[model samples]
Target: MKPEFENTPLVKAGKRFEIEIDGHFAFIDYREMGHQIALVHTETDPELAGTGAATAVVEKTLAYIEENGKKLLPFCPYVFAYIKKHPDWKRIVDERFEGYNKL
Candidate 1:
């Protein structure tokens, strides 16, 4: 992820986190719930698909969550799987989340 995008949420785009790469935007839609962020969807432009844009955005989102002293609820399947594959991310997950242990 680029340094500029590490914490850039496209306010004009409904508060979703965004990464603009090569004119394409990859985004993760989320909802904030008190101290937790519910990551709901991740999408990459058709042109950015398969180019690791989703993964990059996910990483940045996780980092943002941790940096801000919050936890996450991985409602997005991609984010759940990413946490499963990279267990270190689980540390910042909301333990009360139903799927926390699975991650």
Candidate 2:
């Protein structure tokens, strides 16, 4: 059975890492550029893949950015691809921020 991840929370693990399921993490790597958080890398376990967990992480990260009035730098390939596919969140993006082409 697919894991129920709709209610999972994005928990910050460190300065440049965050995870969804405690030790069973969906890889996340990011850097803080001034007030913005630049996504370096993000991935979900193969077993948890395609379940929208990564999207949840992005949503939570965006919310965190919004709450802090900061911008987003989606450098992670997965995240970059996600935003590229979902233009609705473009408003939260800081084009002036670095790491855009890094995707």
Candidate 3:
């Protein structure tokens, strides 16, 4: 992960966390709930697919959540899979999340 790919506040209210690579944007869409956030979706431009851009965006987003002391409700399947693959990030997951143990 690179600092250059950290949180990009380009979108208002911080609903989007994006990483720009080679002019393509890979981003995660989220909704804030006080100290918790529901990661709703992850998207990468078609041209950027399979380039690991999605992974990087998720990594940065998770880092942002951790750094800000926010709990995660990973509603997005991609994000759920990411957590399943890297269980260490489970620490930031909201324990009350319905699928908590699945990750």
All models: lDDT? 0.84, 0.69, 0.85
Consecutive 10-residue window with the lowest summed lDDT within model 1: 4-13
Model 3, position 98, has a per-residue lDDT of: 99
Question: Which sequence of candidate numbers ranks them by lDDT, best first?
Answer: 3, 1, 2
| Candidate number with greatest lDDT | 3
Q: Report the lDDT tens digits of candidate 3 across residue range 14-95.
A: 6788877778888889999899989999999999887778888888788889989999999999999999999999999999
Q: Residue 53 in candidate 1 has what lDDT?
A: 77
Q: Which residue ranges in model 1 land beyond 4 Å of their true spot?
A: 1-13
Error of 1 at 62 (Å): 0.3
The C-alpha RMSD in Å for every predicted model, in order, reads 2.9, 3.7, 2.9
lDDT of 1 by residue, 27-75 (tens): 9999988898999999999998777778888998888889899899999
For model 3, what is the error of residue 20's alpha carbon versus the real structure, in angstroms, after optimal superposition? 0.8
